[model samples]
Structures are given as C-alpha cells and as structure tokens.
Target chain A: MHTFADPLRYASRMAPTKTAVIDGNESIDFAELHRRCRLLAGGLLALGLDKGDRVAILASNGQR
Target chain B: MGVPAAGLVVVPLNTRHAVTELKYALEDSQTKVLLIDRDPGELADCVNHVILIPDAYDAMLSAAQERELGVDVRESDLAGLFYTGGTTGKSRGVMLSHRNLIANAFHYMTTVPQREDDLMLVMAPLFHAAGSNGVIANISGHWEPRSHWPRSIPRSHSI
Candidate 1:
C-alpha cells in the first residue's frame, strides 16, 4: 500500500521542522516540502491532468 | 517528482539529445504536458501544454491551490516512460511502474545505506535513469539534504 508520497507524509509527521531537502543555500523542511508537493500535485490536477497523464519535467537538480 | 506524485507518468527528456531526437521522444511518448527549464523551440508544439520553468512554473504553482488530489494510484500503474539511447535505431520508451521505481530505490538503499546527515550532490543530468534513480533512492531512504558544490570533483573520482 506504500506509494511514493507515503515516505514524505511519514517524515513530515515524524519531524515536520527537520530539513528534508536542500540545494545550495536553499533548504526546505519536511512539512513545507510535503505541502509544496501537494500544491504542485494540485496545480497539475487543476490543469485537467489526471492519473496516467504524461508529465515531462525538464530541469536540472536545484531548489526549483 | 510532481508528475508521479500526481499519479501521472513522467518522461525525463535528455537535454543533450538533438532537437530531432527530443521531438521524436515527445511525439512517441504522447506527452500531455511539457515542463521545460529553457526554450524548447519547435519541440514545444509537440505537447498540449508547455510551461517554461521559473517564470511560468512559479506562476502555475502560485495560482493553484495547495491540496492533495485523492486518486487511487496502484503500484502497477505506469509511473514513467524512460527512453533508451538510440544506438541501433530510434530510442524506444521504457514503461516503468511505480513498483518498479520503488523497488529500485529500495535496492539502491540496501546497497548503500544512506545516513541522515549525508549530503548528496547530483552532478549527472537527471534526464538519465541512473541520476534520477540515485536521487530517488537517497530521498526515499533518508532525507539527506542535497548540496550544490560549485567546485567540480577531481577526474580521479568517477562519480
């Protein structure tokens, strides 16, 4: 039953304020990172995108 | 990350590929949405929606509400379509399920147990499977914060 999002949810609950991801000087806490992910997910859904839809992310690894 | 998190399949296009190759991958994958970090040129026309990173990307995130979609995502569901190097012919899309990726992360973690304080620097282009999979493995196992080292590592080190 464990999905990709489960670990973040668990980590956020376990340590919400802990730094979950960092890229250079920018750092996001577990709770904030989880919230942003949800927001991004929501944004994609708002665009009429649903499950099984193809999304291509072209970017280098960074805070963005 | 947002793609799969939204229960959608991701196609990480290799930036190094020629424009024609990029176009072929997009067309073959039937990508609905394309999020590019830079100008995609004629390739943008291939997808239904193309969002330029930073500017349009930030706007999209800001405009949308912060909520999690309630979707039943199965492990067997296709999570990504990774294209292989077209050494013999045109690159082919490799269908990978959520279980496939998760299993890989677990396997990677078992091989290299990550510590919470360890810092992982992603130098490799994420479009490649190894790069993305390594990042996934690190994050899934431990919340090891990423660091961007300005100085490149010596050539003696392969990684």
Candidate 2:
C-alpha cells in the first residue's frame, strides 16, 4: 500500500525548492514541507501509539 | 499517513471553546491521548495529556519516522466523525470512510478546474469542510496551496 508520504515526496522531487506553503510573512519550500510531513509522520510513529489510534490536532489553518 | 493509519479515530477540537465544552468533546470523542495546538491550563485538568502547538508539534512530526501504526484499516471502517450543530443544541456524528473521502476528492476534481500550475489560496479555517477539502485537493492535485492566516497573501509566478 502507498503511504501518505508518497504525494509529499512526489511534490518535493518534482518541484524541489518550490514554495509549497505561504502564510503571511512565513513560507515553506516543498522539500522542507515534505520533511516536515515526514517528521510529523515519524513523530506520530514514535508515540508508540497504534496506527489507527486517534491524535487530535487543534491548530489553526497554517499549522496543517 | 498520520491519522489515516490510525484505527484510532481522530476528532479535531475547536480552539475557541470553554473548558467544559472542550472537556465534553474530549470525553464524547473518547480521546485517549489528547494533542492540543497549545497548552490549555484548563484542559490539563481534564485531558490526560496535552501537546503544545507549533514547536512541539513541528518537532514531533519532524522527528517522526516511518513506523508500523499497528492497526487494521478497512474500506468501510469509519475514518472520522464530523459533528454538526443540531436543533437539540448538541451535534451529530457524521460517519465518514476513507473511500468516501477519496471518492469525493475524485468527484470534486472532475467539476473543478485544476491546473498543475494553479496555486490555491485557502482562506478558510482548517476546521471547515471547504478548507479541509481544499487541502486534500491541493495535495492530490500537486498544486501549491497557500494558507491565509493571521492575514496577507503574496503574488506569485507559478503556484
């Protein structure tokens, strides 16, 4: 099965440094965003929490 | 992959809420581990765990590596529950599935004009269906999506 990270990796490899997200004065490149998604994915894995175990996120628009 | 792999159901909480309201949502949702955007002192008294937003969250995701989530996922299994405001002053859980989401994504794309070079400005809050769906569309379409937060959007050549 394909992981959620696939599309992220595809974007990064296809566009590399292309700006993926821009929030007001802040911006994140595709590569950095992919890394962030991966890291987040990793962090969720590290929690020792089961895959389907629910994690609630309450951040505003930018954080997602 | 985060919540998708989770047989664990995820419920996004509303930040603009009172302790009691937040407590009710947590308890009703049966959130065993609570991850908050920021530390809510009041929530600490209710939830067993409270995760601070931004830095702490970024670190979690950044440091997160691919590991087995150890849960069985099925096509018909409930993916998430979207609560809607009701006449009884309570909300109803709208059971949604992975296929429901993926199918809807494909259906919506058929109606919308998506170009590889399109850069979408998502001005809605993440909690809204439109906003959340927009994120999904942007991701699936491989188009650059900008979030309007705090405010302001800049001009771009190719988004």
Q: Estimate each model's TM-score.
A: 0.87, 0.73
Query: Which candidate tops TM-score?
Result: 1
Give lDDT tens digits, candidate 1, residues A1-64: 5456765666677778987678878898878877887888888888898688888877776655
Residue A28 deviation, candidate 2, in Å?
2.9
Worst 10 residues of 2 chain A by lDDT: A1-10
True contacts kept of each: 0.66, 0.52
* Residues B1-159, model 2: lDDT tens digits: 246544455666666656666667666666556666665766666555566776666566655665433135665666565555434876555666665654455444545778776788988766555666666657655532333111222222243
CAPRI-style docking class of model 1 based on DockQ? medium
For candidate 2, what is the TM-score? 0.73
Model 2 CAPRI rating? acceptable
In angstroms, give how far residue B151 of model 1 lies from its true place: 40
What does candidate 2's lDDT look like per residue over A10-39, in tens digits?
A: 667778788777888988877776666555
